[model samples]
Target: MNSTGRRARILVTVIAGVLLAALATATVLIARRNADPAPGGGADPVAAASPGAGRPGGPGLRVLSNGLLSTVSLADPAGPRTVTEQHCDRAYTAGGTTACLTPAGALSAPRLLVLDEGLRVKRSVSLAGLPNRTRVSPDGRMAGWTLFVGGDSYAGGGFSTRTGILDTRTGEVIGSLEEFAVFRDGKRYRAADINVWGVTFAADSNRFYATVSSGGVRSLAEGDVAARTLRTLADNVECPSLSPDGTRIAFKQAVGADPGKGWRLTVYDLATGRRTESAETRSVDDQAAWLDDRTLAYGLQRGDGTNDVWTVPADGGGEPRVLVQGANSPAVLPAAR
Candidate 1:
């Protein structure tokens, strides 16, 4: 064929191939967007309900799991609506919203996933370092999490833990507590002193607390939420739970020298600074929740990984009653609207 005719034919072939490829890509994207189930069928109704299914004032527990954050109504605990699904290790809720911490991956650095009440990913904040044990402030204005820097030898994983507070609105690092000393009643406590975990904030967001164990001695720290200042309340403790009134704290304690043998649930009066053990069963790794100023809720694990939820009186009386199964991290709603 003539040179000009051959060149024209070659150009036409290339253009047709490009158009075909573009059409195929578009088709795949359209299919993926519509693949999400609609209402009805075996799909979860709560999740199928628009992106804004659960609003700010709704009755549900927002939980983070395997990088996906979802909400389950307290009334219907099993009905969960996945709001955000990313590769995250943990999730927490504050101020009627949810936040997730992404795990380190090949292509992406660790980040914070913030979601609205409707289970929609609203924003993503890149974190400078790896984060662990994340908690949100009660006011929803601030978020705090522990960051693990260089490696150290701790039983769980690392020795050095740095706590950072971030401004949720601006995504700024507002405060951090890196000092390795434990201060109690205006005195510097030693670092080799306590094993801390389960860090959380009070209702007012003014104070933060954690479960600390030292040389068989266990206690709770009532620290300045903003300044990171700390003061010890009591010792010989396990998982600690704060009451809604902020006037009391509940925890589990080892009844004998060998805590691994088992533990007993206890309550502490913040005002009087007294620790009282309950008549509850002896269990390890138990967590307690305050249903109210007088009522407490907790979970007990059986020989199997399955667990039973129970409730007792904060005043150290009454028999332990069952609440639910496979339930953990119970935060009672405000009497249900």
Candidate 2:
């Protein structure tokens, strides 16, 4: 054969091989994409972002599990539509941030995780005891958690609680409320038995309310985040939840005279100093969440060992109504804007 003809045949052979390789690569890519549907297709959109993500108002309810953080539509409330993989024993979401508490692996230390809008962990704080109560401020600037610690005489309510607050933006932690100057009955008192837990933040995020206990007596105290001071408001109150309007506080008040037996859901008006008890006759032991300006929601323990979420009028007029079954630690996730 001539030299030119031989060169042309060689070129054609190489071109054919290149085309076949390209086709094979495309086939493998398609198969791999089909095998992994995480970003699309069979994936849950709410797990990623909801339609409200770009809208002005579409917040939904979120529930926590050992392995999943499930989200349910507020308007629907039937079944969970989306979920993110998490190990939160308890969780609270607000202002586009979700904070959760999960057990530290292979150790007794617990961890509080601050998650972003995509459900990604932004911060992890090592805690000292079993996770009890977790909350975030209305503005989401502050996060707080309670853990069950052992060793105090007044901690006989099963376990003592260690409460801490965090400023997520600044990464600052107020690990102990005991550091604050506590005023009781208009007088400053110092005692070694001071323990604070079940924090509820105000809308401004600078003021908070929590249960302060000493010598086995519990009281509701208002705290100033900036001043770092606490003043007792009333006795026999635990787990205080500030109303949405910030005018009243819904708290668990010791029923009759025995605090250990349980508490009653009561609302105390800050302006009038008036207190009213909810219609729920059962002893509630959990912090209450304000569903609206007039409704307060809390957890009630049942005989089956499971807890249910119930709501009552903030003014203490109507009977308690069950809102969510088999769930506890209620928080009203506001509409996203």
Leading candidate by lDDT:
2
Instruction: Report clash pairs, candidate 1.
Output: 67-88, 83-119, 218-235, 218-236
- State the local distance difference test value for candidate 2: 0.75
Model 2 regions lying over 4 Å from their true place: 1-58, 65-67, 79-81, 151-158
Model 2, 143-247: lDDT tens per residue? 999887875333256457789899988989999888999999889979987889889889999999998988777888999989999999888888888888999
Can you give the lDDT of residue 218 in candidate 1? Answer: 61
Q: For candidate 1, what is the total of clashing residue pairs?
A: 4
| Residue-level error in angstroms, candidate 2, position 169 | 1.3
User: In model 2, what lDDT does residue 138 have?
Assistant: 88
- Candidate 1 lDDT by residue in tens digits, 1-337: 9999999999999999999999998888677544432211233313443333333355555443333444455555555443443335555666655556666644345666565544455556666456655666666666666545545322333344545566657656643453434676678777653555556678776677776555556667766755656677777654566776777778767667356466778887778988877767666354565656898766665677555556788887888876655544344433223
Instruction: Provide TM-scores for the models.
Output: 0.63, 0.79
